[model samples]
Target chain A: MPREDVMATETQLYTPSTAAARRTSGLRLSRRRVIHTSLTYALLLFGSVLLMVPFFWMLSTSLKTLAEVQTWPIVWIPSNAVWENYPAVFQKTPFARYIMNSLVIAIGGIIGTLIGSSLAGFGFARLRFPGRNVLFFLNLTTLMLPAWVVIVPHFMMFSAVGWLDTYLPFIVPAFFGNAFYIFLFRQWFMGVPGELEDAARIDGCSTFRIFAQIFMPLAKPVIATVAIFAFFYYWNDLLYPLVYLQSQMKFPVSLGLRMFQTANAGVVDMPKMMAASMMALLPCVVIFFFAQRLFVQGVVMTGVEK
Target chain B: MALRIRMPKTKMARREAMEGYLFILPWILGFLIFRLGPMLYSLFLSFTDYAARGAPQFIGLENYTYMFTKDPRFLDSLRSTLAFVVGYLPLNLALGLAIALLMNQRVRGITGFRAIYYLPAVTSGVAVAILWQFVFHKQWGILNAILSVFGAQPIGWLVDPKWVMVAFVIMSIWGVGGSMIIYLAGLQSIPTELYESASIDGANGVRKFWHITLPMLTPTIFFVLITGLIAAFQIFESAYIMTGGGPNYATYFFGLNIYFTAFQSLRFAYASTLAWMLFAIIAALTIFVFTTSRRWVFYAGAREDA
Candidate 1:
């Protein structure tokens, strides 16, 4: 699911040539270069506008009165940007508890994945234990196994351990290293110059220390990429939280947003739900844009680059 | 620092024996205690008839036998699941690649357009479900509004059993931004020299794309295609929230069926069997992909096309 976003960062740059072609296609203007540049800017402005519509629509709906939201001939702009909905969102439906729960799950997931994947990745790339290739391939095998294949066992397992209604079920497996993250980290680690680790070996640095102090530090980019991925996934998690969490207080934003719809039932509150949904997704979008550089690095060339 | 007495005739430091275990200990423990242990327990329980409350009753092969004969819903859901996977895989790849191609043309403001396309990908599934529900509503929805302009009737997006899968497909299209990113990245990785040479050889855009870009991107596409197919098979959340597997069980997807049987109907034994079957299928499919990928995936600088 995540591997594709890494594709976008580099491929998206080629869009400029469309503008170049479009300008040249339409006109017999002598100053083709200037027209192409202006046309490119115009397309860019258009693209920006198109992109902003959904966010703006979400915000406006969130602010509009309930009546205003359901009205036909949709309101393109809100009379006022309602600051109150944010507060209302928090006030309604244990939103604060859900937010806290999301934060804990997201953080715990990141920490666990970072520790688990880094060690496993380092082992695969640098260490030579028995059945190393087999173990690494076994780890990679998990990549294609859909979560549904194990959801029943996963649910029962957590329930039996009395981990249901707690964050443990959500956070624990992440610590064991996700197959994708381990693969990414190992791919990144494989490129870390052997000379460096060898020098550290001669300096009496432990394998673990070299992994900790040297490889760990050097693998920050991939680590950041994995962290960003874990954050988005945890943030987007619906099935896990839906199954594991029985209590309303334990619900994360993902499940919490669903409640807004289910709570409303047939008489769907399109405005409030849309607004709340938009708010719920803000962190994911923000984090993605912020950590995009790492994502690009992962997609383009990580292991093979060095 | 160089007081190494031949480093005990090994490159590995002595500290590795201790810290190595320490580093992996958390993950190993997590896997054993949280995932692996429970998974084994569930497998054992599947062989027995153990409801959450009742004591275990040994019933080996009963659940599996019942699944093949008595479980009609499982069959239905399996059909839906398979249909969905077939539809979704091609649609996602095509749409994602199309957007990537459009954005790949060196257009100005491509960044903003890329971000817009990517926005829905990052949006919560809950929000997306909500938005899609409204958009696909039989009447008074934006999609219907657009359709009316083209002289088409309103669609029963969330209702009508026949059209239910289409609803999921529409929703899926709204989220192609992430895959678009990956295609974009793959595009960027291809050296410009290849395209330039192709252009000099009288290759037009489409021909160049077919000859160079698509071939260069075969690896990422294959990667996305396999993973995407697996994901498509596990379609639970959207069907759960939007349709609730209703409209006369039109969208009763396999994952949703498992959830209902296990959680709602308290049929863990049956659910586990269903899950196990899915696991086997996924395992087989993954193996198939791994075997075939070598034939088509063209890794950079690799000789003989793989």
Candidate 2:
């Protein structure tokens, strides 16, 4: 599909035809290419440095002493690395418990999203159903519905049910299938060849069995994309937790970090706060580095499809 | 092509329909319980007067009337949000596209550069805000330190009401990588032959970009602008964490206003009214975008209502 061409710009730009043209043009092309490549490198390098400064500052501040962090000249790097700030993050607050809370929520969210989105996506993509188009359209409309629209009543509903200060509000919704992820999975599922499903159907497989035994097993890539998105969503989510979970014990990392910052309002411990920020930011950065392609693919597919 | 068969729904088809519903049951249940239920409750709540403790009393648009006529904070938040959207959206779109254009060049280690630029996109909003808070500190901030290098006096980023929104705008621009990748995909999708052909027809680089690239990228640009505007209007986390909707409420975005109204003041009914206003605004804007999109957003294939 044209999508493959779009996604793999790396390979497309370095195609053999272009290499052949460069080779045929020889020295002039080589010199021009050298200048062109250098100019590209210079521009990108400057941009990369500018972009990396905040991250670099975060890491630098995380290891600096409080005095050094607040010093006038702005310590680009500390004269001494206070590795104890990382330990101090746990020592001063319930950082470990916050991480645990975030992990439980993120993991729960991922599991629920995968199961719910995959099942619904499979049904929508592969099954013939009355009212399917209407139902799908309704689901798609929810994508444009901002979260704050229902948040007030959602809070009151949860409060009525006495589910406040628990992870229920954050994790439970993920089990119902997100509109965006369902759409993503539906798109992926639609591209799967009909031959496999046909063969499974010929074997007298039940519809659910066809999905489970045939489709779900082959849906690793889309599942990963959904899981990654859900993980980040849950881990970084602050509003729902802030509104629902009032206690420090129930606070996820995002809320925990916010609370920590607020608690130090007047004093402003830059090193410790930054250390906590790095810990909160680490998992997402690591995940993005590992699954950069999937991240890019998800963004591109959503934009194009919409 | 010569023979066409149309089959009416039979017993098998009805059974398939039932199975489809069964598969999608979780989502349906989830939607009812979580999405549709809360939405209806919110609509009802908007017409009532309730603080957390008592049964909501029917107030008949009193909350909405108060918001429109009496509240200063409400108007301030609306103005601030509008200003933020105006400032952030264009910079995000332009910077995202410019960076993407540079990244599109055939350079070695381009992925590394992309990764660096995208790092902020993955970081939690709370964490990013905390980091930027340090960077925007009145004294000893790296930004001020850099200004010192150029013999320019330090300007308060978060301290001054005039600059706090600008600081938030800068932070939003830092995450432009998200849109940049989408633009990159759009650029990649445009066949290189279009450029080759244009060049052959005596089009220079500037003319080619104006005639070919921008027009071809209209759909993507439209997507970015719509989503960016929606996201900008809903600005919450950074304002909540960094500014706390202050330096005299300069960064008090609409989302933060709803949040504070509901959670902090416990005015569920008023918050509901505010939430509905946001919903209506978003819905109207989305409809506007869709209506206006036909004028400029070019599609190479079958078009769908955005």
Candidate 3:
């Protein structure tokens, strides 16, 4: 039977006369609900449009001629769309190379973060250890420590080791588990039933085997969340790249876009700049749309669920 | 062989501890090398005259003293950062909650709206900052064009000292969709029974929101506030990319100051001092929020009186 039908029948059984009266009032209630819903939609639509103007403006500006971009009454749409601006972005700078550098850093970071964080998280969640609680607390506290606190020394260390102008500074730190991602993994791992581990143990599966074969497979969601977070972090990162990388060839998309802007200096070409910005943003937007559920879940996991 | 002589329970405990350590070994190494070592080295550097060249001279407390007494840029950076936090946080929280409420409504196409809202939050920061530069152009910008429809004159958003921070705050609202998702998650977690029972007690929507929803969401609000405040204090990319700390240094944020001091000027010691100062401010503010959170943050299952 349909669940709604069963619920309706149960409701009718409890109070037949009241149910009939409720039907009449339900019509009025639904009318109010409709009105409320319409008001909500109107407000939401208004806000969404208001919020989306920048993006729309970006797209519009990207396709406009230089003169049209500076026209008095802003042209909503260019009469002749300058689709060439998209290709022009590449002609002007090593944007393709920048995207590749960003990808290398982001992917390398994700791999390291997944390996490091998952191992630590599994250990914390499932193993018995001396000072485990204290250690975990210490790890958590590091999440609040500002990056600036250690950035100077990190730069000095990297420069001393001649890792400057390379992706090493960006990618190498991920091998050390990030406190936030570890926390996420640990939280997810903690929720798995103890019986699964016990069953595996009874079959003589080693702890590492149980973690690798059993827990890791079951942690696809958290893994996805961590990977997405890592991607976002590395992809959007500007400061680290800005501080470490000096060569234009070593620049990530973030620094590359900045270089494009400053390269022109006073004579700003608005359309081409918009086009480059759009290109730089494309991968992130695409990834987000595809993996949005993971993004939302990751954010919620960071909240005070415990 | 030694473990085999011990009690089985103790032996198992020892094995688990060993396994735990093995699993977390990577993290432990990372913590020591990347985090703890750098932090101590940074602290040491802050008290020296290490200017990225031949710097071994220890200048005890001189950097801190100069920062406090003589550096006008330090004060300016602090003023701008505080101004940004003030202008940005409340609006971000309120708008995030408002949009979350709208999204929580049982309306069709709400997911589409949610995605549209979140789209900006996930885009590359450098790209978005560059895009906003065009939007905030004095005369040719879409914002000005729209304002002119109401007969308001064009304002120099990035160029004007008074409006640069306002421009930044306006740009920031585009990313409020991030917090909106978190708020939506918090809203979903609230038990429907609370609202049902409140309806039985003749509570209106506003009363229910005030008496139940707001209190229930305090923990989420607290989380958002802390994270948002930390992020706000780290503002650098937008100011650097869009305005270059601008016309008359209006947008010279602390993060930018730290960057310029360390990288551009090669004043590593002074920059380290600046960074420590930032860390102190962030830590103090975070500690303050955590202390105050006990009064306002509501945990659902925890003892109410406690």
Candidate 4:
């Protein structure tokens, strides 16, 4: 009933008890458990193969030389690994600069989203005000407005304000709490017991202090989740960079990779593009490995199925 | 007794109001400047035939009329996009759900299984497109090589217009991790007692799942369906990056068409109208789902709001 979202911070849902319950059930293993487990394992394996097949080929293709890649009787593994492809990506395009730009945008976006959403969420969940629901819904409606419709206007507004061709247009708006993030944090805040706040108030905490101390401390899991989601968002996003930025130095990995693909068009060095893709995928995977539990928790809490 | 209007001190209420706004100031400002301004401007842009060079001359209804009456390409694209959405949305969601259900049962190295299924999602859409492009490149690709082992013929992937959309669909299936993860979360939240009770009453695995899991998880499935439908309808990146809406425009999606009209062609007015059409279709579908969700979308742990 609450915090349903998409293109979002689903990782904000990890509360300890529910996630723990999922991991450590009180029941003992039995015949039914064994049978069910085996059946599920078969299903999981089948699905995993389906999901992994494309990726497997991608990696294998990346190791093959151009001639090898386009040869008859395509080889899954190259007789000779084309390790040079990775280096070629850097030599061929502004990939390093793109990576740097992505890192900056993602970090800026994440920090801005987390701090701004937390503050706004605290206001909505813990503080009372008129027109809150109406205003919140208004914010949510904007989510339905296709991003394309807003592009020209955003471009005009940014150019008018002289923030074009920089990360300012991409990153600045995120400092305002996004609708979904605020909704997510609001839901979590509502569930925090009121007594903790009362006690904090008695001990002379300001509303802001209570937020930073009481709510935020209880929000580490969520904060971590938002950090990961926001990181992935700005890092991989393509359209915004394509529209707002023109300089090669300003390209994120998404748009930069596009340039690589375009430049290599028709004479595509498959290995090079695949290598760049793998490189782009690395940070997100690494973060997911560490934050998988929190990520699942965020999904559960937000109920962000769609 | 007279009903006394309990008037609170104006200062406290005023301060609370100010603080609420202050807390939400970041979001409000962004919504107005970043979101609202663009949204309104785009609506206005949709009507005029603004040739990119000068002031938008009022060409009321012309763009919309052209799309319906004269533009055969628009109709072709609409059919292609809608068919693509219809085909992909159901297929991917089903695959994702089935996998999630399987993974819900306790299995060895479940987390690793999760990571594997989720691999493509981490790689991002562009990477998926690049990888898949080479995999299905017909004569020179690994896919046909694998098929040849089973004595199957080579199939043109990106080049052939007929199989182009299918290629996109097949490629899209690789990233089921996003929805699958949500389904897993939905599974985690099912009060185990429901399953226990069902089994105790002689429900087998299938029955227990049907009676318990399916009902309990309907809300999530519904959410996924609506969002998936919306997302599928607007799929742009893979088609854009992989096919360039090409091979006779077999996969030129409406979203891409709109983008081309607005950005590439700089037909801002025509692009605006196209965007409006997109907005209308998506909005209509969202409302339809919301209204019909009453028949399904069960909430566990609490009653649905009246």
- Give the per-prediction TM-score of chain B: 0.91, 0.93, 0.96, 0.93
lDDT of 4 at A41: 76
| Candidate 2 clashing pairs, residues 3+ apart or interchain | none
Better of 2 and 3 by lDDT: 3
lDDT of 4 by residue, A53-161 (tens): 7767777777778888776766778898888888888888888888889899988899889988988888888776777777777866776667766777777778778
What DockQ class does candidate 1 belong to?
A: acceptable
Better of 2 and 3 by TM-score: 3
Runs in model 3 deviating more than 4 A are: A1-27, A304-306, B1-9
Per-prediction TM-score: 0.85, 0.92, 0.94, 0.89
Q: Best lDDT goes to which candidate?
A: 3
Worst lDDT 10-window in candidate 4 chain B:
B1-10
Looking at model 4, residue A145 earns an lDDT score of 69
Estimate, for each residue in A1-306, the C-alpha lDDT of model 1 and write its tens digit: 244344443444767565555545535444775776576566555645644555665666677776666655555566776667777776667877777889999999999899888887777777654445665665655555556556766776677789889998877777788777777888888888899988998998877789889998998888888898788888877888887888787789889988877888753566667767777777777877877667656655522232
Q: Candidate 4, which CAPRI tier?
A: acceptable
Q: lDDT of all the models against the reference?
A: 0.73, 0.85, 0.88, 0.79
DockQ of 2: 0.53
Candidate 2 lDDT at B185 equals 88
Question: Fnat of the models, one by one?
Answer: 0.40, 0.76, 0.82, 0.63
- RMSD of candidate 3 to the truth, in angstroms, is 3.8
Candidate 4 ranges with C-alpha deviation above 4 Å: A1-39, A304-306, B1-14, B301-306
| Candidate 4 CA-lDDT value | 0.79
Model 2 agreement with the true structure over A1-306: per-residue lDDT tens digits? 355335455544668676555445665757887988888788888888878888888899899987887677788889999999999999899999999999998998889888899989988898888678788988888877789888877887788889988888777888889988999889988999999988888889888888888888888888888899889998888888888888898888998998889889843688999999999999999899999988888888888666
Q: State how far residue B122 of model 2 sits from its true place (Å).
A: 1.4
Candidate 2 lDDT tens digits, B1-306:
132323337988878878888989998998888888888888888899888887889989898889999999899889899989888889899999999998988777888888888877777568888998888777877778888999988988987998887888887888889889989989989888989899889998899999889988999999998888777778888888888888888888899899989888988888888888988888899899889998888887657667
